[model samples]
Target: MARIIHRLYNERAFRRERVIRDRSNPLDIYNDEELIERFRFCRRDLFELIEELTPDLEFVSDRNAALPPSLQLLIALRFYANGAFQNTVGDMVCVHRSTACRVIRRVSLALSRRLARYVHLPNEAEAAAMKQQFRQASGIHGIVGCIDGTHVQIQAPSENEYLYVNRKGYHSVNVQIACDANYKIINLVARWPGSTHDSRILRESALLQDFEEGRCNGLLLGDSGYPLKRWLMTPLVAPTTDQERRYNTIHSATRSVVERCIGVLKRRFYCLHGEMRMHPERVCTVIAACTVLHNICISKRIPLPRHHQPLPVPEEDVRPRPAVGIEDIAGRLVRAQIINQL
Candidate 1:
């Protein structure tokens, strides 16, 4: 009886200590500047966001002490900023490798769910503002967003491995993004396999449907890889006149913002630049989470890291598709009209 009581008393003391330690940890050890350098957010903001994410990241209050939410956020941020191996991040955060993996996955999923509100395309009025901004920046009229596709490398899957292998002979996901004039991503689609063509992905998206139904306004400027439509504009394949040539030049300059956005995204979240070891579905979740964080940085006016350079995108073979509707013809006429004006 005495031994059992002693054991129970010890257990209670341990639990009390752990609860106090967890509560006091973030406050005592990490200052605001240290938090910013490590997690890329001010300490107060990080703590508040972690508090909000508690419902998703919190584990059952079992006998074992669970890791604190702030610590989990720190692990996720470090992984995102450095793209380090799971064990490496574990060492930095003083957790087991498997625990670090769980923390990252859970935190990323929670962020993607709660933070997606900031990453969407603007509404009608906001889009008008976006168009005015683009026009002022590049003298391009009615341009809502710039569209492009990039390959995010991933490990070869056990099933459907060939489908993920891109034209560059590597496993990847062909991520499509549409960005505004300020280099913020307005739309993103990342589930497609690397082997999927850029044009097919855009054609199959809900954004295309919205544009076709006239629910959305403004045209998306894309490179030659995208199909020209009433709502989506591409540079002329072969410019025969000076007007067409001038149009292409302006189109290239304005559309390049999407490329820069992608570059900044990869630079900010090094995980995208590195070969993601997670499954494709998990990778998509991570991508979504990173995009949300990227928008947050833009909203807060966080300065980008120096020496971050945009990489060159490969010019893929243009795949022509049959345009059956009046929309295509109308788009061609608009292009011609714009060229004539130029």
Candidate 2:
């Protein structure tokens, strides 16, 4: 009888604690400014978005004391902002490690569904406007978007891990991103392993098909790693003439936008800056989530984090090629036409 009475008392205490925690406002812990600094979004805005996608009701039973939607969003944002482990993030928000993991997965999945609304491939009219903006910034005509690939480091996978090892002697995901002048991600393809070549990723992408079908107008600027195609423009192998040198200079500067975007992205989300310890598939979802968040930050005009800085792009290696090929001829003819206008 004493034991039963004790159990009843403990249950009541636990219920009381849940009531207090749920009623407690997170704003008391951190003001709007502090909340924005801690997580990238202001408290009001973040709560509204989370509330829209996730109902206010607890995901788990009230007995389990599931986290509020606001706390769930906060925990996930802190994870993305710092790339800290589950335990560390949980401690920050007063939750267990396992609960932290569940919260992050749930929030990531939720945000990823809204990716289409945030990140999109430009339509014909949008592409024209983007190209015009690029021309105004730099006198490069027929340029639609800049294309490049960055290696997102990841832990060795369980199966055929060797395939994930890149030339840099590390496991990574080779992510291809296409951005316009405003650094908005027009298209993103990130399913390939690190060992995969940048050119291969592009060739396998739907964007390549669009170019081939002439559905995508204008040219895409890429670095030496990609092949010279009718739609894709790469720098000259050896620019002997003054005009060729000027063209290469302009091409390098214009293409640097994609590199800059990659830098900004990694800096904003530190998870991509170093090796991420997660399954390959989960890593892909996280990468997509970060991309969507990056776009949201841009759309909302949110200021970058205080310590944010871009990562430096590595230098490219030289590659041998055929003296003369059909693709080479086509690339040169297109270049010659652009140079004449210059």
Candidate 3:
């Protein structure tokens, strides 16, 4: 009887010890000295966002490696940072392939939910403040924000070839974004089919609906690909010999803010530059998370590349009247004037 009791006690002690050891160990994945250090810095934003949004989410142990919440987040950011495959991530983190996938998916969902709070469309007061800032920065009065769509490459799905194929002959996802005059992302809409026209997507987006209902007041600057609307502005299409060329030049210069913003985003996050290998549904989530990350980095005053200097305007020269009818010229002038008023 004494021997049996001793054996039972030893077994219980052994199980408790094993549990304690498991709880304390973290799985280290990457040995890249710089990456490890950088990942440590990246955790703060994710941690704060998660804590603020989901106060109840806690790090719990599973049968596989019991990853801490912070470490789990680190894994996702690391995935974005390097754009590596799951097998590669598993090798780096010292986990199995399945474990790496699970970690990434869990972290992605958590971050997406937490980060959504930060990317909402601005209210009236907030929109007014943004307008004032834009007026001050760009000297463009009555400007609320700029809107544009960019294509992100993705792996082609065998089932829906046309839906995913873009004009560029690649599988892509269209991400439409709205930014304040100060070039901060105010809102993002990412669910449109890749082949959808930018103008059509904008019409269907909440931004257009809100503006139409007078819930929001701001003009979105867009390229000619978008239709001309009272709430949206596009540059005057070239209609004459000299004026047409000048308008084109000016339009390209002014519309460059959105282009620069997109460039900076893709440059900073290498994962976005190439085709995203993840499922189609997750593409939107990844884009949103990256935008949120961009905002966080901006708020933290992360250094970004300086805006390119605008090209010098060409010398004005009087040109002979075009053979086109006077009615055409007058119509073009009217359209240009309407755009200017907006």
Candidate 4:
């Protein structure tokens, strides 16, 4: 009886010593507009996100006082919104720095897992509508999407650190984004290192393969860094004639859709606006997850921040690559045909 009583007392003491951090409602401190300002998600949108992510984020066991899924999301969003230190951001919700880091990764991964649902190539009907929209908006016919690559800065990694260094003389991951006329990201490829060229990133992507096989309809407009494939159009490097110059101007303007999408993405998620201190792998995951969230915000018509954060460094590095390989004759013919039509 004495030993059992002692064990019970020890158990009670241990329970008392364990800490359960307080989770406050951000809505209490910040009104709807203020909350959106801080976290970039209005309350209604936030609740919708929380509901969507709860199934993946909620813990099965309540051990050690697991964070409420809503709190977990808020903590992650705060990190994403401002790119502040983990501890500093976590303190807003009374979680440890480590806990905040883990939560950010968790929430990022959760969103990334659902990336296919949010980001994807347009289907048959969707593609037809997108083609018309692109033509109407840019005066460039048959443009289904615009593509570009942006370098996301990151802390030096443990393995192959040299490969992460970009021409801007910094560490980063080169993320390729493809967006439609409306600045909505349709597809994203985020796994490549910063040293990888924009053309190579496209050359090796399944997106290119799908286009090669004629799986998706319409041409994709890209900057000169990409090859002028039959399905991918690049502006003429030397346009001697007025019509050629006009085509170049139109191509540049049409391709700027992807650039604007990148701008809005970084503007919305400041974490991508600056260097991310996580590992390269985590950085990739975070980028993809952010892309997914960016699409959601675009669909819901979330207002872009009034102040534009500086866009990512110019990616059309050093004009066209020196070794662009043999030009695709078929691609040249396509451009010429479009030029005549124009």
Candidate 5:
């Protein structure tokens, strides 16, 4: 039986002859040149953007001694691109794990500081442009931006699990973000306790501080979870009339930009989809870094899904309507609720 088996294996190998040929067309190898050219073009723009967004650190006297800023940017991009851990990034970048960690932190801080200038709430002119764009795209006017909060999972701490556990039954941090109709993040505030309500988180955030101080003239669109306030609007709880129902539908459709942004953000960074491996304190920093990168991608006009279009705005009656006093009441209630919760 052993002899038969050996003969059978030998016969199979003999039947399958290996072929080596030098006659293959050399032109096939040239096909990669076009790909290389495209890659170079992409790299050129990406590198320049990274250089502009990454601040020069004076802490290290010899810039040449440290990793190249391009390499540092590559590390951060890899984090968002692949959502890999430090060790994996180190392996791919050919650096030590500790070095990878340090590089990421350095690059994160540098980009966050530099990119903050570009990723802020829109000014009057910019807001006006966005309004006009919304009018053109969705036919709705007076729309500024959408606001919402999402929970990011974090590792549970042995000392205080309650502070980290959210309503979703996970250890997380509540992150509130505001995005324009274009889906570009305008404002972001992370570091709230997971147990905190969305309304409470918004009340305590600096994102709302401008609106509170009457510095912002644009309105913020939100869901029912957010308390109503001047410069901030929420959908009506129940639509009693056709106009109210239509308004609520429009509100939901347009307000979906924030939710879409959050979804895209989570889909891009797998680490954010579930519990992060890092400590809780570091989670906020990571989140901020991710958001800054998100804004950077947006500024570059990276292609996204077509569903990301702003919700269509319905035509309104030209007649003047009575001013609703709900904004003040909502603001007061939100402030009081936040204080009580704290």
Candidate 6:
């Protein structure tokens, strides 16, 4: 009898904790600003996302009524916008913490259904315009995008843990991102371990095939950590002449587009900025989902969250001797042409 009474008391408390004071949706209590503040998206965009992900999120389960697609998206977005613990975010919506964790995974993989739509290489029409913009902005001709690798911090994995330790002495994933001048993520490669060199990631990527096979035209501006290909240009190791100095200046300005793109991406979704607690495979999916959403936010002209701004991209290598790109003869000729023009 005493144990039964104790159990009843705990059940009542749990029921009260799950109940919202006055609203059906906890989201209704917040204004548009608060909605954006908490979820990084207004109701309209959130609803659209809900509609797109509804099919993917639909299911038959005991938790169905409690975990609708919209609410699941809300929970996931809240997690992404603020890298708080699962239980903490779960508390905001009155769901159990375990439910929140499952919802985050579900919503993340659901978003994956639309991944290829938003993130893609520029088409023929986009390439011409992008090249013109790159030329006008930095006087760097025929440049369509900038490529760079940024380390997304992650919790130490149980398997092959040493592979994830980057040069910074932290476990991370080295994500390669290429973006057009308009701060759009045109291409991304997110599966490499942090210990892998940025140049190696590019070397093994299909993006190189795009350039090599003529599927994608226009030059790419990358840092010294990437090899200098005929279609990819890197900064000079040492600039002696005025022309070489001018080339490096313009190259950096052009490359800063991708850097700022990364800054905006991590700023919009704080999950990428901090140590994500999920498995690496799931974390990569979340990163892909974030990139898709990042492109959407850019397209919709959504304002950045307060205090969110582009970060200065740090160098990948901080050792006594920084790594430089492997020089290619044809690439050198192409880079010289641009410098001479400058």
Best-matching candidate per lDDT = 4
lDDT for every model?
A: 0.81, 0.80, 0.63, 0.86, 0.66, 0.86
lDDT of 3 by residue, 209-318 (tens): 78778788766667766666666656654446565555455545555666777766676565777888877778778887778777776666554433323223333223
Better of 1 and 4 by TM-score: 4
Ranked by lDDT, the better of candidates 3 and 4 is 4
Which residue pairs clash in candidate 3? 29-92, 29-93
User: Can you tell me which runs of candidate 1 are displaced by over 4 Å?
Assistant: 1-34, 306-327
TM-score of each: 0.86, 0.86, 0.73, 0.91, 0.73, 0.90
Candidate 6 segments exceeding 4 Å error: 1-24, 61-64, 313-326
Q: Compose the digit string of candidate 2's lDDT tens values, residues 258-314.
A: 998888888777778888888887788888888888888777777766766677865
Candidate 5, position 2, lDDT: 100
Task: State how far residue 93 of model 4 sits from its true place (Å).
Answer: 0.5
Q: Model 5: residues >4 Å from true position, as ranges? A: 1-41, 53-66, 136-140, 304-342
* Candidate 5 lDDT over residue span 248-268, tens digit each: 666667777788887767655
lDDT per residue for candidate 6 within 51-132, as digits (tens), equals 9898888776745355777788888999999889999988877787888899999998877767789989999999999999
Give the Å shift of residue 340 in candidate 4: 1.6
Ten-residue region with minimum lDDT total, candidate 3: 317-326
User: Candidates sorted by TM-score, descending order?
Assistant: 4, 6, 2, 1, 3, 5
lDDT of 6 at 304: 87
* Residue-pair clashes per candidate: 0, 0, 2, 0, 0, 0
**Cα-based lDDT at residue 4, candidate 3:** 100
Q: In angstroms, how far off is 73's CA in candidate 5?
A: 2.1
lDDT (10s digit) by residue, model 4, range 40-96: 888899999999999999999988888889999999888888899999998998888
